[model samples]
Target: MAPHHPEDVGMTAAEQPRQGGKGPRRAVAARDRTRQPTEVRRRLIVDAAVPLIAERGYKSVGVRDVAAAAGVSVGTVTYHFDSVQEVLSEAMVLHIEQYYAALSEAAEHATSGAEALRLLVDALFTEDTDRHWRMWFDFWHAGEQSTDETFARGQADRYTAWHRQIRALAERGVADGEFSGDDLDGFTARFAALADGLALQRLRQAPPLTTQQARHHLNRLIERELVPRSPA
Candidate 1:
């Protein structure tokens, strides 16, 4: 039989108690759901899950926790998502979108594409961004461990988009006569690869690649290939 609503999925034991006929939980749920649109409410759950997952990680976050985080009911979380994994997935997608939006904002505010690239590098390698980095690493690790091919494929798709964004920055640099276009493809791949590698190294912490050092290395790449004249 088709589910009557998005909430019709079989409730787990954890969810059952909260939804039992008439109680504070049910009353609280009623108050929370008053005239809330499905998509808007679902967004609330996902947004709440993002910070929790960022701080607590995927294994630690649960539907109950998300409900508490969102000031909604546990049933509301299950109403929006069929599984904890699905909730986390949606949260990660939001996280990535916000991360990229930050990068774009940093880049867009600059006067030149070279400045944009520099701003992007600076924005990326910051102490404030460590939480973002941790979340991404967690997502990547989940993708690596999952047997589903879509996990890997989705990661690759995100990577491709990241590369394209970097390349677009370089294209702007070239158009402004600030960078050479001779090896744009090669430079894009190298820059993206180096960023990932350096991030992992910094996170690894044995050899201790500082954020400053990472920024310096990325800036040097820009200076070497993209600068119009000798790096100042």
Candidate 2:
């Protein structure tokens, strides 16, 4: 067969303006290319499983539900996972990781520990985080009911990782003289628990906890936790 180029695809170098733009044409072409099959399928499965599991409890969402959501067959879902539990387990891990990535990205711009804390707290008590919080609730409810080994282990891991990140941020505040508590572990635990409680309330409360209201409340809690110290 003769060689084909962009020209063969009805987009020649000269005929189309060589503006070197990432315009819709380029985007469409990118989307048209063959993606890694395994990755594409796995992502489809995870993406489908997440919202369904979040909107409906994981226990309520079956292999058929995931397959329908992903626009695939039950056999396809099974091809990727042994069962719906397995898929939801994987989705939980992905969800937590993505959630942390978002928080970390927001924290990266903060120049001080106090600001970092503010950013983290603000991120949690917002409408944007509502879905993730709901997903966590669904996962917990499902785990409590099924007591699946994989879900249990994944939940433990995510919980540990989340606490670790929060502790690190608290430690940063301590180092910056913005936070003070002799028992840093205790400090972090209290803060984490408060954040979780507030987040849930924000999600479930009618009219919802306004982001500013949550942030102000968290700010006062942090202020109480802070200790005055000379700059390091």
Instruction: Supply the global lDDT for candidate 1.
Output: 0.80
Model 1: lowest-lDDT 10 consecutive positions: 24-33
TM-score of 1: 0.81
Per-residue alpha-carbon lDDT of candidate 1 for residues 112-184, written as tens digits (9 for 90 to 100): 9889998999988888888888888898888878786756787787888899899999999888877766788
Q: Give, for candidate 2, the lowest lDDT window spanning 10 residues.
A: 4-13
lDDT per model vs. reference: 0.80, 0.74
Candidate 2 lands at a TM-score of: 0.77
Q: Which residue pairs in model 2 clash with each other? A: none
Q: Candidate 2 — what's its lDDT? A: 0.74
Which pairs, if any, clash in model 1? Answer: none
Off by over 4 Å in 1: 1-33, 149-151, 227-232
True lDDT of residue 165, candidate 2: 79
- Model 2, C-alpha of 15: deviation from truth (Å): 36
Model 2, 17-126: lDDT tens digits are 44675434333354333343777778878888888867887678888888778765576677667777888888877887988989988887899877887899888877
Error of 2 at 171 (Å): 1.1
